[model samples]
Target: MIKLKGIVAAVATVSALGSSAVFAQDVEKVIEARQSFMQLYSFNLGLVGEMAKGNTEYDPEIAASAAQNLLALAKMNNSQMWPEGSSKADAGLDEMTRALPEMWSTFPKVLEKQDALTSALENFATVAGKDLDSLRGGMKAVGDGCKGCHTDFRAKKEEG
Candidate 1:
C-alpha cells in the first residue's frame, strides 16, 4: 500500500517537474520556499503559544490571524521538495528536522494529532473574534496537539 506521504510526494514531484522551465540551477529558491513555510508555521505557533500560556496579552485580531495563517500554511502543497534521495538520505534527518520517520511510519498517530489540530483550529475560528477567555480552551488544545506530535516526531535540536 502506498503511504499517504508517498502519494503526496509523487504528486509534488510530478507537479514540480511538470511546471519546470529551462533555467539556471537554483538551490536557493528551494531553500527559500522551505524557509518561508517554516516562518509561517513558527510565527503562528509563537502567537498561539503566548495566548495559550497567557505569557502575552491576547488580542482577538492577532489570535484570529495566527489561527488562520497556521491553517493556511498547513494546507500548502509541499510534498515534492522532500524527495527520497533528498539531502536527508545524502546527509541525515536528525541534522535537519526533528520529524522522525515515525511521522509516516505511524501514520495513524500522526493523523490523530493532525485531527486534534484541525479541531483546535476550527474551535479557535469559532471563538477567534471573541474575548480572550472565550478562546482560551481552544488555544490549549492547539498547543497540546502541536506538542504531542513534536514530542514523538521532532528531534530535540542541540542548542548552539
Candidate 2:
C-alpha cells in the first residue's frame, strides 16, 4: 500500500508539470497569433493606399472591394489572438515579428498606441474611395501608425 501511494504521488507530480508546460505553450501560441494577425492586417490595408496612388494599377472594382475588406478587418476584436504565454517576454520574437518584449512590460502604453492604429484605420476608410492625391495624408497617417507600433513592439521583416 505504501509503495502504491508513493507511485501515485509521483505520477501526479509529473502530470501537473506536464499540464503546466502545455499551458505555457498555449499562451505562447496566442501571443504569436496576435503578432501575425496584426501583420496581416497592416499588409492587406497597405494595398488600399498603393492602389489609390495608382502604384498597382488594379481594377477599380477589385480595388474598392479590397479596400472595404481591409476596413472591416481593421475593426476586428482579436482578443483570441493573444494567448496565455504569447508575450514577447515569454519567447523571443521571430524574423518577421518586430515586437519587443517591452511591449508586454509596459502594458497600457502599448494599448494606447494600438488605439492610434485603429484611428488610422478609421481615417483610411473615409479616404478609401478618393483619388491618390486626396488620400495621401491619410496614407501617411496609416503608414506612420504601422511604423509606430512596429518600431518598438514588432520585429523587422526578415529579408529573403
Candidate 3:
C-alpha cells in the first residue's frame, strides 16, 4: 500500500509540472503576439514619422495607406494577447516582456489610454492624405496618445 501511495504522489507531481510547462508556453506565445503587434504599430507609424520629418518624400497616397494601416491595427481585437500571467512579473516572462504589473492592476486607466490612442489614430487617418501640413498637424496628437500609455504602463527600457 505504501508503494502504491508513493507512485500516486509521483504521478501528481508530474502532472503539476506538465501543467506548469504548458502555462509557460502559453505565456511566451502571448508575449510574442503582443510584441509583434507593437512592431506592426511602429512600422506604420515610422512611415508617417519619416514623412513628417522630411526624411522621406511625403507621397499623399502612401501616407494615407500607412495611416489607414495604423488605424486598422489600433482597432484590432487584441485582448487575447494580454492574458493575465504574461506580464514581466510572471515567472519565466521577465525577459520576454516589458509590460509592467500596473498595466493589469490599474485596469480602466489602461482602457482610457487605449481609447485616447484609437481616437488620435482616427483623427490622423482622416487628415493624413490631405497634405503634408495636415499630416504634421495631426502627428503630435498621435504621438501624445502613444506617450501617455507608455509613461503610465510600460517599464523603462534597460540601456544595454
Candidate 4:
C-alpha cells in the first residue's frame, strides 16, 4: 500500500510538471502571435509612411488601401495575444517581448491607448488618399497615437 501511494504521488508530480511545460509553450505561441500582429502594423504603416516621406511615389490607391488596412487592424480583437503572464517581466519572456508589466498593471489605460490609435486610424483613413499634404497631416496624428502608447507601455530596445 505504501509503495502504491508513493507511485501515485510521483505520477501527480510528473503530471503537474507536464502541464507547466505545456503552459509555457502556450505562452510562447501567444507572444509569437503578438509579435506577428505588430509586424503587420509596421508593414502597413510603412507603406503610407514611405510615400509621405517622398521616398516612394504617392500612389493614391495604395495609400488608401494601406490606410484602410491600418484601420481594420486597429479594430481587430486581439486580446488573446496579451495573456497575463506574457510580459517582459515574466520568466523566459524578457528577451522575447518588450511589453512592460505596466501594460497589464495599468488595466484600462491600455484600452485608452488602443482607442486613441483607433481614432487616429479612422481619421487618417478618410484623408490618406486625398493628397500628399493631407496624408502628411494624417500621418502626424497616427504617429502620435503610436508613440503615446509605446512611451508608456513598451520597454526600450536594448542596444546589445
Candidate 5:
C-alpha cells in the first residue's frame, strides 16, 4: 500500500510539472503573438509616416490603404494575446518581451490609451488619402497616441 501511495504521489508531481511546462509554452506563444501584432502596427504606421515626412512619395491610394489597415488593427480584439502572466516581469519572459508589468497593473489606463489610438486612427483615415498636407496635419495626434501608450506601458529596449 505504501508503494502504491508513493507511485500515485510521483504521478501527481509529474502531472503538475507537465502542466507547468505547457503553461510556459502558452505564455511564450502569447508573447510572440503580441510582438507580431506590434510589428504589423509599425509596418502600417511607417507607410503613412514616410509619406508625411516626404521620405516616400505620397501616393494617396497607398496612404489611404495603410491608414485604413492601421485603424482596422487598432480595433481588433486582441485581449487574449495579453494574458496576465505574459509581461516581461514574469519568469522566463524578460528576454522575450518588453511589456511592463504596469500594463496589467494599471488596468483600464491601457484601455484608455488604446481608445486614444483608435480615435486618432479614425481621424487619420479620413484625411490620409486627401493630400500630403492633410496627412501631415493628422499625423501628430496618431503618433502621440502611440507614444503615450509606449511611454507608460512598454519598457525601453535594452542597449546591448
Candidate 6:
C-alpha cells in the first residue's frame, strides 16, 4: 500500500508539471505570432520609407506592391494574438510581451486607433503607385496613424 501511494503521488506531480509546460508554450506561441505580425508591417513600411528617403530608387511597381501588402496586413484580424490574459503583466508571461493591461482597460480607444490605421492604409494603397510625390504626401498620415496607436497601446522601448 505504501509503494502504491508513492507512485500515485509521483504521477500527480508529473501531470501538474506537464500542464504548466503546456501553458507556458501556449503563451510563447502567442507572443511569437504577434511579433511576426508586427515584423510584416515593418517590412512593408520599410520599402516605402527607404524610397521616401531617396536611398532606394522610387519605383512605382515596388511601391505599389509594398503598399498593397501593408494594406492587407492592416486588415488582418489579429484578435487571437491578444487574448485577455496575455498582457505583459500576466503572471509568468510578463517578460514575453510588451502589451499593456491598459490596452484592454482603455476599450474603444484601441479600436479607434485601429480604424485610423485602416484609413491611412487605404489612402496609401490608393496613392502609393501614382508617383514619388504622391507617396511622400501620403506618408505623413500613415506615420501619424501608426504613432497614435503605438503611443497609447505599446510600451516604450528602453534605449541601450
Clashing pairs in 6: none
Candidate lDDT scores, in order, read 0.65, 0.66, 0.91, 0.94, 0.95, 0.90
Query: Model 6 lDDT vs. the true structure?
Result: 0.90
Model 6 C-alpha lDDT per residue in residues 1-160, reported as the tens digit of each score: 9999999999999999999799789989988999899999889999999999899999999999999998899899998888787787888876678888878988768889989989999999999999999999999888888889888888877577
- Per-residue CA lDDT of model 3 for 32-151, tens digit only, reads 888899999899999999999999999999999999998998899898888887778878777879998888998878989999999999999999999999999999999999899999
lDDT value, residue 95 of candidate 2? 34
Candidate 5, residues 7-100, lDDT tens digits: the string is 9999999999999899999888888898999999999999999998889999999999999999999999999999998888998889999999
| Residue 101 alpha-carbon offset, candidate 3, angstroms | 1.1
Q: Rank candidates, TM-score, best first.
A: 3, 5, 4, 6, 2, 1
lDDT of 1 at 78: 72
**Which prediction has the highest TM-score against the true structure?**
3
For every model shown, what is its TM-score relative to the native structure?
0.63, 0.70, 0.92, 0.91, 0.91, 0.86
Highest lDDT scorer: 5
Regions more than 4 Å wrong, model 5: 1-13
Query: How do these models rank on lDDT, best leading?
Result: 5, 4, 3, 6, 2, 1
Off by over 4 Å in 4: 1-13
Model 4, range 1-160, lDDT digits (tens) per residue? 9999999999999998999899889998998998899899899999999999999999999999999999999999999999898899998789989999999999989999999999999999999999999999999889988899999999998997
* Candidate 3 lDDT (Cα, 0 to 1): 0.91
Model 6 TM-score, 2 decimals: 0.86
How well does candidate 3 score on lDDT at residue 115?
91
How much does candidate 1 score in TM-score? 0.63
Please give me the total number of clashing residue pairs in predicted model 4: 0
Model 3: which residue pairs collide? Answer: none
lDDT of 1 by residue, 66-142 (tens): 87877776666676543332232233334544446666666567667667777777777777558777767677776
TM-score of 4: 0.91
